[model samples]
Target chain A: MIITKKSYTFEVSPQSVDFNCQITLSSLTDLLLTAAQYNAEENGFGLRKLNNNGLSWVLLRLALEIDYFPLQYETVYIETWIEGVGRASTTRNFCIRNKEMQIIGYAASTWAMIDHQTRRAQDLFTLDNIGDFASEETVPIDKPIKLSERRGVLTDVFSAKYSHIDINRHVNTMRYVEWISNGFSPEHYSRKSVKRFDVNFMSEILFGEEVKVYKTEEAGDTYLFEILHNDKPSCRARLIFRSEK
Target chain B: MIITKKSYTFEVSPQSVDFNCQITLSSLTDLLLTAAQYNAEENGFGLRKLNNNGLSWVLLRLALEIDYFPLQYETVYIETWIEGVGRASTTRNFCIRNKEMQIIGYAASTWAMIDHQTRRAQDLFTLDNIGDFASEETVPIDKPIKLSERRGVLTDVFSAKYSHIDINRHVNTMRYVEWISNGFSPEHYSRKSVKRFDVNFMSEILFGEEVKVYKTEEAGDTYLFEILHNDKPSCRARLIFRSEK
Candidate 1:
């Protein structure tokens, strides 16, 4: 078994969340972003020292599956790696665990190479020569859930900071949910409850990267939300809201 | 009414809970910690920055009341003020909100100033000239609930990071809950479910602060937990475990 040696772990607290006990979803995007940073730093491609030629990896989508949740003061580890990069999108994966290293949650994100200054998506194939970051076998891609199924509000934009980055890697998916969900007024939430939210996690969003979250309330019953790394989509979510508050 | 100009809100999430939607007892401790940061920072006694001469505020106790459960992303404010500095402790208070200025939750915390290097309680009287973070007004303090009434694990020592700090001041409460709750083994949680937890919000832990979470499991029924800042108790909590996996 290929064991994870340093599964970037760190502690996070309540101020981390919007109003929710869970980590915010956008924070999740930030986590994915940090995971990329960790991977990049290990490969000498993360936040560059002198030039400040930062690496900004945009989240394409995120698919999160959680078994049990965590509480405040608990320390967690985010283990991630490049499943491999492809011609179009670079696929990254994540797993959140406890001190015991038990998998508490997992996420899969799709990222695209982008120019830091221009804020333009760089073609992965073209950048293989310049950037030291490259992958050999692009194993599997987390297939985006088909359009025929359910659609809710996808998280649109997220406000982030440098601290959101974990020394521990990636911001954490729950933070993304919190940031995206926070867009909606809490007063509205009490009046409206989230029944089911389907968030397909794609890639990671780094710290201090201001992300725009877009959501199209579909059919007046559910909403389809998308968190974008500029024009490229990062995470798409479908939320079923109820009138409770 | 004195209002804070730079106010932030929150949307509580599922991650804040143990297995139940209720916030983990640990989160209450985080809330207290967060408020303490504000109380300290407003007076220029913020987090440890550059110098060894830093004051690490430790939590003594907390009394909180949840009038109505604050759900995920339910916008709430931790409106806080100091109630003067005692010989050993600084009193802090907070009120939660649902939306814009809507009171939803309320809490109060007592903090002890300590020397970061020595890890021993400091003389609050020395800072007497500064007085408490807030004026001494007889604000109501919530009564502490029985520790047995709470749920979750007596958390064990867990490592944390500096980036966990938020713009507001300390580590957000939700992130703490998420990580701390995640500290337990997935198998342990899958085997024994979290029933209930009640935490007393304590003192704040700022950036670059390394803290330890100590837990004591009692017969798998309840766990006594404490988040120690530099070995001094920052917060206290009680968690209830259930028969589930």
Candidate 2:
């Protein structure tokens, strides 16, 4: 039997670092997604296998909390496993550790398997053995919160291009974080660092589709964002920041 | 004494692969840049050290030719060294090898030192010991072509956003590649793979500035691109593609 729980190690590279020399949020998301993919492949039901059956996996929601962001050239260990497998969705949890093996961050993500052609969620029951991989263990952080509708002011607008689309013909998750992060100016970043992040991916945005990002300040250091396509909500996010000392 | 040459190994992760399961050009470029930064730091003249002295390095031109793209999870090695140093710029060469130690690709790049504050090209001779790092070797590939001005048909237009700007406060080189690659649709990519690429950076693009991309067919399989800002050329590229069999 293939193992479902897996751990991977990586070194923070220069390309993944930001102006502050710490790994950027997008890079952190990439690392988590990479680990998820590795675990999926180890369980005999990866994107490659799903694509062969006219299906693909899509991230629906994610929440991350980091005590400290790793710096360039620092070693990082990510232990990931399936927390639960439901009828049409599943949850994956990650433990992010530093070189000292101390827990530095935790991330949890929700995903859905959808038909590649119809783009409709497929019943997870069809995958007969996927449940075998669920360890039923959970991260000690709150689950990704369901973001409510936000009718905020328009912050930016751009059409999805080739780079935004992934193999499944939808926008890459990190691109969404990039759009959200871009909502702030350099001056804003100079004084603040992200503490926690929550995002809900309600719908898929395809290539060449125009996307408008809306932003509103919910409270002190807390901002909410809604990404709309053709006036329909596609994704929502809430970001909490702390002033850098 | 610092080592002027360096070798690094990396595994092509899922996030770096494209629809064909081969590593995307953008990800490959990121790996190359990462290796360059690592080698520079090992030589004690990295971006951090240079920035401390009010100086920065900027990519001027790059050329890459690959025989086969690596697949996801495949191990690859990159060996890089400074080939030559001139009055104002230096040439860096890279050898890309697959897990079997077979050479798979070769890349060459030229970079210039500039004042961080003035953004003016700095005299390389002023860096007393930089000459000691030149290996005086070459990558056995054609040098990056000096692309002449091309008045191609308009392809894409957008305002440069904050995410496009790197720590140097200018648009990142990979962002330009994205724009140029997006000029071709998914249908185009389905039938062709890039055989070689050459890009030249003539000027820096700033945040929130309007930019346009133009493209022209040079011959049967060669295409030229030029990126303009305020009607002035910022960067140019030439791509040669081979029809996938």
Candidate 3:
């Protein structure tokens, strides 16, 4: 199936950045959702209204690999496509770009159309009653990063605390990034900088779950590490720091 | 000690709400920071630029009281002040309002000052070089709400799945609201209106945590319930539905 590949572009803004002076994970999630909504609208649905059946789409899972992050005021684009339905879930892909069109990051996610009355997963093909929104580019799930051999220059252990947590039952992805970067004694949080980070969830981290982070130097001045859940891999990623000072 | 009460206002916009149609937790955090920063700057200290010495202010704890959320295109005002300063923390309070000047919500938070080189918490008023940030209202922390008895109208056992969590590593607050609403068998995720809700978090819920919910029908179509953790209160709230769908 050829799913229409739709894309969205946004410029990095100061308000979107964090105290660390970097775009936050929450913002990234918004970016992904915004892009997905764009594709959904192009296919005959948008956020402004419910479907013909009064149902709405909800997120399920997200996986990604980030090579680098665009700095503040740098224009970034997100290209998205539907990857066909698999059993109950539908997959989508996104590519992050800079003003120069460099691919800074890429991601894939899955969502379920839920029935508003039944509170159950609704069949995506019949979701909008418009038949299957044909796609021009039905892609496969993205190849996940090999999380083995995790190493980085800075590794720290953190436990989920009431203050650092969010409304989600899991560690907010952006907060994890913020905490991990903060583990660094570096001075980038307040500076204009560039960053690249990727993390995958393995074991569910709950409130008060203590986890250790392992970091080792990687190629291209990137630091790679794995968030270990009781010595097992919870999430692994490589973060490229523009300035380590 | 009369602490000077400082204030600022921001208009609520659609973009401020996330996919869930709620003013995000981060928006609240940013609002708190804005109020605090204003007071700091008025105290003659540039919170952003500390002469490159790197001493910075960090958030510690925050308690917000939101009785009602403003609708789209509404102008909301936020008034804040440093309630007091302890050895390691400074407490601040935020009062929210609509154009009518009715108190819609309030939040209290603690901030800690840290030396950039040490990355350790420092005494709140120890910096001799620190500028004048003063407040007129020196108050104590608002006593957190405690859960109590309620009537029973609905019962739900919800498992905290991986996707149901956020970075704070617990159930996302808004998602909890969403899910509790989801628990309504007669209504799925299609409620057009949420009249009023008061949720008090008792115990922290984590990833993979399962909650047993009990609801009661209150007077005038309001529903009261408590999310229980091991039979104790994790979150308790009364929801009034205002949307006439």
Candidate 4:
């Protein structure tokens, strides 16, 4: 019998940590994505298989709630599985545990298959027997919500560079996270740690494209961010922090 | 007997690859550093021990020669050991092997211990029993050399940001590699792969510092780079590429 749920362990490297010696949000996200990739590969729907059909999975939305950030050299176990599959998209859930095997975080992500040539979302039902892997599992937190538009203060504007693009020649998800994280000062990170983070990818940003990042403070230690390309929203995110005190 | 020469294996993750699906220079550099950290930790001279004394290891120079770039998901084993120890610094060398156990790359790095508060280099001999760990093994390539001033064309200019700084509140080694790699276009990377890369760090760059990157094309597929902070040379590097054809 095929295993529907899979867990992968990663040790937080020195390069992945920030000044606080805790793993950065982008690195944590990378571990989650890495676990997703490994699970999908084992289940026969991996990127290599999809690429052969001119299709690839694209992350549409993700929401993560963390109780503690893993420190440098700390080991984190991330378990991932498919929650459900829809005609247009699919949901995947993740459970993050510390070295002691205690659950510390949960994440929910939505993804869609897209054609490489057309860059259009493909029908998930076209994939053979993909729905059979759905575990129907659910995380405790709410699903990644649809972030609305907000005319916030412009924090940064720059052209996308080579380092920002990944193998797909599009702005990487981690780059977006890094840009969002850069808006806050180191002092802000020192006193407040991220409690919850939600992001929605609307459109793709290509290399050399001029992009803008805007951030607005919401009530109760919440901040909303929107990244735009040529006046069109490419991605939107929300970050909620908790006081260390 | 203490294990002085150690080998660590790493699988190239999807997030670490470039558009060509091969690991980028920055990612490769990170792996080398990670191996160095592991080896140092095992030998009882790791960052934790150094930090306890208000001192830390700092990279002064590095030179890497690559015969191949490992593709995504490919496992590369890096064997590292201390080559020598001096009063002011130490030399470490790395040999990278592919899945078939074939040597694909070798790297040499020099590091110095610095007092965190004073930001001054301390004598390496002060570390108890550090000399006993030296294996005196050397790679074929020349040691990392000091680069001279070059009036190359300016490639990019930007201020150091939060993500650029590491736990030490200084610019990360990988960031400098990224910046140097960014000077070349995707087309350049597609046609040519790195053969040798050498970098010398003259000064540390902190967050919010305005930095300028300059690139000069040398003879026969070689390039020189200089990064400046406040019109002073902060770092210099050289890259030699092999044509894919």
In DockQ terms, which candidate is top?
4
Q: What part of the reference interface contacts, as a 0 to 1 fraction, does candidate 2 reproduce?
A: 0.47
Model 2 CA deviation exceeding 4 Å by range: A1-4, B1-4
Each candidate structure's TM-score, on Cα atoms with residue i matched to residue i, is 0.40, 0.93, 0.46, 0.98
TM-score of model number 4, chain B: 0.98
State which candidate, 1 or 4, has the greater TM-score: 4
Q: Residue by residue across B50-92, what tens digits does model 3's lDDT show?
A: 4255676655445555655565336778887765667787667
lDDT for each candidate structure: 0.53, 0.87, 0.57, 0.92
Residues A1-245, model 3: lDDT tens digits:
23467668776543455434445555675677667876777777654454445666655556655555555446789998775565476767787877888877777766676665665677666645333543435333354344566544434564554333332333545555544554443233333243444555555455557777677766666666667655666666655555542
lDDT tens digits, residue span B87-155, model 4: 989999999999999999899999999999999999999998998887787899888988999959998
lDDT of 2 by residue, A1-245 (tens): 33378789999877777656678788899999998988888787888789899999999999999887898789999999998889989999999999999998899999999999999999987985998778888998899999999869898887887778788877888899989988887667778888899999998888788899999997779999999877789999999998873
Model 2 TM-score on a 0 to 1 scale:
0.93
Greater DockQ among 1 and 3 belongs to 1
Every model's DockQ: 0.06, 0.57, 0.05, 0.80
lDDT of 2 by residue, B1-245 (tens): 33368789999988777666778788888889888988887787888899899998999999999987898889999999998889989999999999999998999999999998899999897886888888888988899989999978997887887677777877887788888888787667778888899999999988778899999997769999999987889999999998973
